[model samples]
Target: MNQENRAGQWSRARQVASPNQDARPHGEVSLLLLHAISLPPGQFSGDAIEALFTNRLDPNEHPFFAEIDHLRVSAHLLIRRDGECIQFVDSDQRAWHAGRSYWWDSALNAWRSKLNDFSVGIELEGDDCTPFTKAQYTSLVDAVGWLMARYPALTPQRITSHAKVAPLRKTDPGPAFDWAYFRQRLSQAAFKQ
Candidate 1:
């Protein structure tokens, strides 16, 4: 798959613009945040994810939908279980994925709050209890490497999980995600380029 991100859009990804995005404050894109999500909490391969991002989700479709359909949220990219990548928001823009989160930037020696202002969010088609697919991991590594290349401030250490940033309200890309394996594969992917 082509990994080049041109003007905040990946060459190989399907674009689906989401209204839940806006200009990034200070035009900063320094952090990469990983998140896990599945419509109805566990199901996959449905239009619910896209619909939610685009503000078209039907609350009557499911009970859980009723609770979250009103939320305005989106991510920069989503890697499906089959490794199909979809881009909902431009990387240069602020997607409403991370809410009330904070990250400590060692390079700047400061604590950054409201991560959406400086971070790119990627959502994997998964939940907290289930392990993500190999295809997803491969796509994620490639995507992360591409982002790191484009954003000089991003690095392996700067890439973190949603749970870590929003410990009080979120616990996704949770324990099921293998951090060591992802780091190793990401290194290999980066090395290849």
Candidate 2:
């Protein structure tokens, strides 16, 4: 779970190999969904997030773990508060992050569902109440740049939040997330790269 180098994966990230993933339906990645998560609520920087994504979380470890230990979800990448990057599912594959989600598709001129078929998921090591670290944002900006270079269709405009896609069930990367700051950083990174 600590692979340093691998094919079809980001070079800078540590690979954890989550099983909650599969091949993309049509080999297209056009969206980037940012999500916020923390083990046991507002806590930060633990193996619990990785354990949960890899289906190894012990329900007895924590009350919150018991509630979500049944989930089989994974994100393509996770950016930790310390700015460490972890690759769970390969970006070319479909991570089970977006469940029963939909978004407006301008090309199709309609609301589209099944976002996992064509979207890359990134989980920020944070909660709705805590402000994400500057390190996390830096790592995220770098990761997004790397992903953009690989997936031409994944523009900054295409990047969104889990809350936007699943309003009724989720509100992550929430009010504490500064969209303006992240966007400015992303814009600056784009120019530098």
Candidate 3:
């Protein structure tokens, strides 16, 4: 993959624009939020996730989809189970990923609310109870390394999980995610960059 970000879009990811994005209030991009998702909760490899992000998901397709199809949400990128990356929103724009969330920004030395204003959200194709694939980790590290290089404000310490940002409302990139391993891979990739 090319280790560069142009026009807020990564060359490695397949471009799939979603209408659920808009301009950032302050054009700030600092935090990297990681999340987990699956179409039918645990099922993988389906167009349901894409459809949902694009506001094209048919609620009648599934009982669970019927409940969440009305909600508008989109992440900056999504890493599939096979390690394919898809971009739903440009990095320069604000994606509707984080809802009612907050994070502690050590750089600012204070709690920052409304994470979407300055965060890039990445969705890994998996559920809370399942482990992410090695390919996903590798792709994520590469993507994050490029992002960190492109955005000077982003740091390894600033990278966080959605669960931490929205503790009571969300639990994703959950217990099954290997933060230590991810950090190790990211460090290695950053060193190479």
My TM-score estimates for the predictions, one after another, are 0.95, 0.95, 0.96
Which candidate comes out best when scored by lDDT? 3
Cα displacement (angstroms), candidate 3, residue 189, comes to: 1.2
Global local distance difference test of model 3:
0.93
TM-score of 3: 0.96
How do the residues 128-155 of candidate 3 rate in per-residue lDDT, one tens digit apiece?
8999999999999989987887889999
Question: Which ten-residue region of model 1 has the weakest summed lDDT?
Answer: 1-10
**Best-to-worst lDDT order:** 3, 2, 1
Question: What are the lDDT figures for the candidates, one per model?
Answer: 0.90, 0.92, 0.93
lDDT of 2 at 95: 95
Which is the leading candidate under TM-score?
3
lDDT of 2 at 173: 93
- Each model's number of backbone clashes? 0, 0, 0
